[model samples]
Target: MDDFLERTRQALAAQPFTQLLGATLERMDGEGVALALPLRDELKQQNGFAHGGVLSYLADNALTIAGAMGLGRAVLTSEFKINYLRPAVGATLVARATVIHAGRRQAVCRCDVFARDGHGEKIVATAQGTIAKVDELPAG
Candidate 1:
């Protein structure tokens, strides 16, 4: 588990945008990956709710991580679709993702985004993503 956590940490560090979002890899297990991000004013939309892009970011990254967990290699989000079920109003956002299927070079994953508040967690969005395994990251 420690090795997996370290791998997750390294992977997160490689993504500047994910760092800007202040997302942290909370846990990774045989089932999937979990991530959390604090809700900050800067992350909110004009309506004072978490922006759709934020939720999409969370889902895409979480699902991509979940795919990589299954393959034990880096993965990229080839495509994803998200459905906003409700406004995200909370102190933090949580994303839980699991791989639905893993092929040799690609995986299908599902992620559920929840808004955590005093009342507890509520489903705000859900996503399905296709992640492709990458043997190595290309030099930028």
Candidate 2:
């Protein structure tokens, strides 16, 4: 289990876009996974708030990671929907993803994105995703 988790983490970290977005895997367990992204100029919209796309991408990635843990294999997102609750104008954002349902070939997960400031945290977005389990292709 430890080996699998380590390999997954390494693979996730190697994603260039994830690195570009400053996304970091904070926690991972049998139930779920958590990810964090710090607010930076590149992530901001013209109005100086975190872009909606950034939140969606973070939530998608978080849920995908969690679903992969549940399936014990690689998975691809079959569908995703996101709701924007409020503008994200904090120093950082945290996405907590939990696997709501798991089956032999499909899994469903939800992610809540929170904007964290010195004062407190606020729900900035929420997302639900369906992922399809896929076998890892043999390496040449």
Candidate closest to the true structure, highest TM-score: 1
**Residue 104 in candidate 1 has what lDDT?**
92
Tell me the tens digit of each residue's lDDT in model 1 across 24-135.
Answer: 9877888788899999999999999999999999999899889887766667789999999999999999999999999899999999999999989999999999999888
Candidate 2 per-residue C-alpha lDDT over 29-107 given as tens digits, one digit per residue, 9 for 90 to 100: 7767888899998899999999999999999898888788777676888899999999999999999999999899988
The CA lDDT of each predicted structure is 0.91, 0.87
Which stretches of candidate 1 lie above 4 Å from their native place?
Answer: none
The TM-score of predicted model 2 comes to 0.92
Worst 10 residues of 1 by lDDT: 68-77
What TM-score do all the candidates reach, one by one? 0.94, 0.92
Give me the candidate number with maximum lDDT. 1
